[model samples]
Target: MRKFQDYRDSVHFYGRIWTAAAILMLLLAPAAICVRYNAWPAASAVLKGLLGVAPIFWTTGIIEVLTYAPMLGTGGTYLGFVTGNLSALKVPCALNAMSGAKVEADSEEGEVVSTIAIATSSIVTTVIIAIGVLLLNRLTPVLENPVLDPAFDNILPALFGALGVVYIAKNPKIAAAPMLFMAALFLLVPGLSGAVGVLVPVGALIAIGVSRVLYKKGVI
Candidate 1:
């Protein structure tokens, strides 16, 4: 009984309640109209893409989130160049079931069109976030040590910090050169943006090589 009380005290139940309340509110709200009208076939295509990818991503946390956004933007933009809307290109976001935001209607080239905002772009995102936090706080403790949260939370920072050090130590002459190279490569390389799953490390290595070459010649 004392252990249960201690767990409750440490876990912050109001936060969970607040989260559930927020998600409940979002569930009760009206979403953008086109989503309501669009055939499930359209929405299903989008949902499959997003849901399939989201779970694989859940464990990656924030860095993956930050990196994937730009990468997918680039990839999706290029993908738009081919396969067309049958690829569901215009509404890349319809892929997720959780998003409920609306897009306005517009006429283009004698066509009327509308888009479903990405699930991430929905006004209800805050509720999803709250629910996620609530679930994490409520559930993780049952399977793991509570203190492990604070400790494991620091892993990303530490790993990136170490990476930064290795980067600097490996190439001290042109600190910004590798960064600029990566940025440029990500931008200029055809179909390379969303490919960051492949591009980042490749770009980083190419950047390091170029920076080293430039530094050796004192041109950087």
Candidate 2:
């Protein structure tokens, strides 16, 4: 708890700054894409927004950063943040108004640099979130049906499922059985999905476990 609190304190301002940067980047992504690809600016803007928010569709930074810490080494958390968030946002984010840089592969201190970039991305995300709140305030009165709020909730599960499948495919030996087992557990346990929000993970894990086990035992 203390460590988390400390991290929060240290990263708070940094996060806010990054979020502001991201909003600017998102706003400018369309123009850049239009120039680069000779695409329509409005269409490009929509695409850019979709891509910018794609990471949120797949996984929250909390989950991505947390999940990778043990997977990498001492610098795992920072690296994970970089890779995960970029995987979320893609190259359009780095080139324009958000203007964060990529980790140069040849640079020895790339990890430290990447950490800074990830922190900035978080800041950009925060700004976007604030904007979201404002948009919600404007839209709230018109949206009486909670079901139609935003498609984000549904899209996130689908995106995560796709990513999980990729991860499972890449590392089936270790990821397969445990994932399925946990998912089955999630299902069998009464009210577990509602309790722990297990549907997405459960489905992803099951697919991985089934695919790997079938492949391994020559069942498929």
Candidate 3:
């Protein structure tokens, strides 16, 4: 218990430090650019721009936190959020690691596993990005090849599809409702594809509701 508490405290301490640093670094780049160009926008203009999109971002961020935090745990959540790209990369990686390790995400073992997974992922990603930058000229044609465009576009779907197959197989009953609903919704509306992040929590809630009904009926 003492060790677990210490771990939690340490995670919170460093997580806050890194999160603050990331925010400061993000602000600094724009500030430096503004100072260099002497092109500071009026406060009202900034507010106007933010007004159009800030709410959507805030909604998505909040939804993502609620939806992903349970599976990510504290340390993993902090690292994943700071690193960004949670939906596409960090979330799937951490979840897969926990699943592979057979650890419940709410447990101490899961926290440790998640942190290691996310940290490893962050390091590997940075290394790859650095290498990619160095070889970008050489890789550009291959990366931009029309033949690979479809593969690039479906990367996220493929990642989730693989993970979903594993989890859905474990709980087909619980997965059925959300899977059917989402499949139909996407097949019909299609344009909501851009809003998958927001829809994730909605699907989770629908699954929860369906599970509750099934449980009450002693179906599963």
Candidate 4:
């Protein structure tokens, strides 16, 4: 217990320091760009931009924290959030790693595995992105080719489809209701497709509720 408490304390301490530094660097970059280019937007214009996206971004950030923290553990949460791209990359990578390692998330072993997975993912992603940028001229035509556009467009669905099959196979009782609900929702209101981010919490809530009911009924 003491060891775990100490680990948590250490994580909180260093996490705060690193997170603060990252925020500072992010803010500084734009400020430096504005200063160097003599192109600072008006305060009102900045406010307008913030107003337009802040609500959605803030909501998504809060939802991600709630949704991912348990699966990621403290160290993983700290590093993953700092690195960004949680849904598209880090979260899935950590989950897959934990699954393969047969570690229950939120356990000590899970924390270690998740952290390792996220760290490796972040490093690999950075290297790949760097290489892609360096080869942008040569790769642009291939990447932007119309013949390959459909593959690019379906990448997210393809990724989640494979992941969904794995997880659903493991916990079909818990997954079934939410999957059906989301599928029905999209079919009924195709227009909401653009707002999937906002719907994440809704699906989570539905799944939780369904799972709770199933548990009470001893169905799963």
Q: In model 3, which regions exceed 4 Å deviation?
A: 1-3
lDDT for every model?
Answer: 0.45, 0.52, 0.92, 0.90
**Better model by TM-score, 1 or 2?**
2
lDDT of 1 by residue, 1-220 (tens): 3453453344245435555676665655544344676533467787888798875444333333343333233222222222122112233333221122222222111111112233233434556657767898786675378867776767545654655575467566656666666667767885654444444445456666877789789886
- Where does the lowest 10-residue lDDT sum fall in candidate 3? 1-10
* Candidate 1 Cα deviation (angstroms), residue 82: 31
Candidate 3 to truth, TM: 0.91
lDDT value, residue 205 of candidate 2: 60
State residue 7's C-alpha deviation in candidate 4, in Å: 1.7
| Residue 96 shift from truth in candidate 2, angstroms | 20
Off by over 4 Å in 4: none
Superposing all C-alpha atoms, what RMSD in Å does each candidate have to the true structure? 22.2, 16.8, 1.8, 1.7
The top-ranked prediction according to lDDT is: 3
lDDT of 4 at 31: 98
lDDT for predicted candidate 2 compared with the true structure: 0.52
Clashes of each: 3, 8, 0, 0
Relative to the unseen true structure, what is the C-alpha lDDT of residue 78 in candidate 4, on a scale of 0 to 100?
92
Estimate the TM-score for candidate 2: 0.39
How do all the candidates rank in terms of TM-score, highest first? 4, 3, 2, 1
